[model samples]
Target: MRQLAQSGKFRRDSTLLEAAIEETNTEIQERLKKDRIDFDFDPYFAIVRRTLKALAKEMIELGVELGKSRKSNRIGERQKFVSEAQTPFEVIELGLRNAIEGLVALPLAKECVLDLERIKQDYSVEGEWCPFRVSTGNLKFIVDDDGTISISLRNPSETVVKEAKEVLIALASQVYVGN
Candidate 1:
């Protein structure tokens, strides 16, 4: 019902936690004010609050001197160390996702989640580029020129192969339109 300012600098004494909530709610209300939507807002706020609180915890632990002068605490070296601490798996995953994001129409994680099992099925070049494949699961999919998508049923026995086929068809359609 009210507007929350997202201006100025972050403050230590301000109720940032509450301010974030009010700010998010105000934005959501403004965006949806024209729509005829009947839904609960508490669940959304709960998730936002949880995430904001977690970030607040990280900020506190990182200390008030997070971005202080490099001369005082060697800020550049501290950042280098933090960046270097990431595990190989984390780096690889980041790279893989970045590659997919750059090469494909979909977000990396969404693309991976959608095509992982299907990609594992093995590919034979279809054309200069073919927009679709039929997996062992009989999934109909678009094979990204830049990716090897694997497709398999997480619980093969629980779901029909037709589901994968449907996804593949949808993916192919998107590729056709996007390209």
Candidate 2:
């Protein structure tokens, strides 16, 4: 929990530095050595990346265990293999659900969600690379200025990719048409 809190702080600091670098051409070395920042930018990101990687491995292992147990429970019945189940995706979906639920429960978010259906999808052009081909519930999109597009739907069970693709197309089209 402490490391997670520190990681969050690092992320926020990195975001600020990123903006400053863009706006004023700040030196990366200066950012690294600056005592003003709570966390060293490079080391902070390294820690976060390592932690996330470990977490993914642990989640995968837990999924395998659950799958084994589930299969064992069906011993004499119809041999349904839980090993083929959507374990990892299910785990990720649970986390996403919790976060979204929390957001919805917040007074500010609840009040701001008046146009629930019209909520705009936020897009980012830069971030860490995604390892999975598709997600189960959350949505990720990348649309470049040159009309190139890529999307990964966190929820493969739903139409997340299709919806994000449509939005990306609309956004790209608007940009192209000088809207």
Candidate 3:
């Protein structure tokens, strides 16, 4: 039922850790004020509290610092590390039913948690592009002398979302970022 303060200047990764703690604590407080949780969700609430409180501890220990001289501490590597730290919070933030299901599957060792968490971010709900990947699906394209362009995605399922088709129609007008 209350709001947390805006984040201050981020001098280090600790800033994010502090913000995560504040966010989870605030969410718990609001739930207590506004919801009927005591009847059934007290244990789950404890898990939520404990997990989100340490959202950054293992990650900070794993070398997600901005200027770390470690070889694997590059920006790309940091992106993966940050995603690992954010998985538990995402179960709350994104309302992902599948993720919650995965978390409930128990008997997993804590050591395996890192790679398992990485799986959570390995994809979008839809899909992604990779230039190196040889797209085996039937893809057709054309570029006319007048520079008109068109593309066709031939999916094996033969079902592409209407939104994706709409996007393809408008794609030519969308300026390429690098260009």
Candidate 4:
């Protein structure tokens, strides 16, 4: 964390570094260092793991197959090593502050959300790469984006639904206390 912060990407804007200003690099360094030491993975990540397991179990019960999309893009590992942030600290500082609406980058993310729909697929997972494609659409969409956007209220073909139900049953059966 110290090495990443000292790399200088977290420096406040130069325009703000004016004469007579109370700001100092020493303060920034200390704060970053402090946050790094205080930053607990549990406050941001452990709960998330629990939540995913529960949700995945639920989805399986609901018979959501989350059929394969394209392929694994290794999003988790890549994001853990963002281009500007070779280290995790840089990514956190640059993206997430104290609370994220969120990584609370990328809600302690590369977070895979189940949109419960098939559309607008964005990121690709790394650690637990999914054979199924998904978007953090998280059921949230930009209401005011450019383009001819249209929403169709519908469901998949009967056969697809049947297959999904079958798969859901299979998965739900496999689900265990640790799952």
What are the models' TM-scores? 0.29, 0.21, 0.23, 0.18
For model 4, residues 1-179, the per-residue Cα lDDT tens digits are: 22222233333322122211223334544677977753333343445444554443443333222111112321111123222322121112111121112110221222123332223223322223223322222211111111111111134444433343333222212211110
Minimal lDDT window, size 10, model 1: 86-95
- The sequence of per-residue lDDT tens digits that candidate 2 reaches over residues 50-167 is 5555454444455455455445652111111122211111011112321211100111111111211122333332433322122213544443333233453343443543354345
| Candidate 3 colliding pairs | none
RMSD to truth, every model: 15.4, 17.2, 18.4, 21.2
| lDDT digits (tens) for residues 83-113 of candidate 1 | 1222111001111211211111222221222
Per-residue lDDT of 1-179 in model 3, one digit per residue for the tens? 01111122233445555665556666667678787554445566566556654544444434433234333332211111112222221011111221211110111121221221222233211223211111113333232222222343333221332333333233222211111
Model 3 lDDT on a 0 to 1 scale: 0.30
Q: Candidate 3: TM-score?
A: 0.23
The prediction achieving the highest lDDT against the true structure is 1
Q: What are the lDDT scores of the predictions, listed in order? A: 0.37, 0.33, 0.30, 0.26
Clashes of each: 12, 8, 0, 7
lDDT of 4 at 133: 28
Off by over 4 Å in 1: 1-14, 36-40, 60-63, 70-179
Q: Using TM-score as the measure, which candidate wins?
A: 1
Which prediction has more favorable TM-score, 1 or 2?
1
